[model samples]
Target: MKFLKYLLIFLAVIIVIIAILAFVAPTEVKVSRSITIDAPRETVWEYVNSLEDMHQWSPWAEKDPDMKLEYRGTEGKVGSVYSWDGDPETVGKGEQEITSIQAPSRIESELRFLTPYESKADAYVQLDETGSGSTRVTYGFESVSPRPMNVLNLFMNMDEMVGPDFEAAMSNLKKLVESGGSSGETQSEMAFR
Candidate 1:
């Protein structure tokens, strides 16, 4: 019984340490993924900047084919928003707005989700010339959780949850830009970015 008591004490100490570490972790977590596309930076930038074009490339939209999506404000400009409501629990409901924009270069947006769980985040996509014909596209999302536990949970699984979407979006962007029109990427990992 003495060994059991010691083990319990050790476990409790470890849990406390983890909770403290989670509290000390950054309140705002920024997750980003980047890839090089064999296309002009401007082409890649144009496709990403337009809220209306997101239906063709966003992974979450692909998850629910019947999701109701709406567009508001002028296309490809600041203040434009893309709102989607999905029946699939995985897809959920969300809105993305262009809070700031600089065409063919950078876009900053406010992302709000209303289903599965309600959350808000700052999203940005940046395009940069990497080589003579290659462009590096970087996508990032930053969110702040009021509770330490929420931050800890997001910290543990965010990369795994969002990385593939970033990869798929980049792949689609690359194919559309390089092909001068559309993509043949049937799945998330089928195309090169």
Candidate 2:
């Protein structure tokens, strides 16, 4: 009886500690990476603005080449959605919808993960003219964890987890743009003209 009582007390203490930690843990997480490309902002924006073009340089796509993809609405404009279902152990499944576009400067989207876990994040690409013919591209995502789930943020280093993928994707984008390998103007780009 004494051992059982001790065990119950121990469990209660642990729960209280976890609850406290949950309240103290950060509720928001952000991860971002940037790369300078040897191409003009307009050229870089062409690829970044189009979901289809961006997928061409996605590291996750390289991880699961056979991943199934689906698109809805206009190719690169607001309200457009890009969805993918891939290796459950690697890429998982998710959909991203373009939320806003600021011409050659910024593009924002909402990302929803459906498998492995369910979560939503705001994703963005920012472009800055670095020089006469150079552009700096920043890619990032931010998510908020609510309530007790915020405790998970304490264990997750989102920057460490997603940074390398962003780096590789940026490297791929740089190579493609520098090689003059754009897949051509997307509907959004054409409309912007």
Candidate 3:
């Protein structure tokens, strides 16, 4: 009986220590990653700005082929929305609404995740033409969590979790668009106004 009591006490103490550490951690997390693409700004913009064409090089979409997707807006202009429902652990599911867009230059969106955790984030992608037929693309996201999780997330890296996917998607966008064979590609450069 005494041995069982001691074991219980020890386990309780360990759990308490872990909870305390998580509470003391930072209250929010932010991550940003960028990569320059070997493609024209116009080419890269077309891939990201349009909801329908996202499938061509989207790293996550390809992850779950059976994921349900619904899109809104005209092709890729501003006010477009992309929503998907997928397996919780693998893709969880979210809706992204393009709030502002500046064709071949910048796009900002509100991303809301509904599984694992419910959170909203501001996501943006900007492209700067570096000449030599390349665009320096910067993708960034900021997420804020509440209370204990926020502090715990500070110790964890959201950028690390999400940045690799962004990097690969951008790379694929560069290759697909510049190579000039994607059916979604439009002849004219995207216009922001």
What is residue 4's positional error in candidate 2, in angstroms? 3.5
Ranking by lDDT: 2, 1, 3
lDDT agreement with native, every candidate: 0.78, 0.88, 0.75
TM-score of 1: 0.79
- The weakest ten consecutive residues by lDDT in model 2 span 184-193
RMSD of each: 5.4, 5.0, 5.9
Candidate 2 lDDT tens digits, 1-193:
9999999999999999989998999999998889999888988888888788778778898888889999999998899999999999999999999999999899999999999999999999999998768999999999999988999888988889889999998887887787677466333343354
- Each candidate structure's TM-score, on Cα atoms with residue i matched to residue i, is 0.79, 0.91, 0.75
Candidate 1 lDDT over 1-193, as tens digits, reads 9999999999999988878877776677678888888878877776777776655777776778788989899987889889988884678888999899887788899999988888899998898998687889898899887655554764577878787888887776666667666432333443443
Model 2 TM-score is 0.91
The whole-model C-alpha lDDT of candidate 2 against the native structure comes to 0.88
Error of 2 at 127 (Å): 0.3
Give the per-residue Cα lDDT of candidate 2 at 10.
100
Q: What pairs collide in candidate 3?
A: 25-151, 26-151, 27-150
Which of the two, 2 or 3, has more TM-score? 2
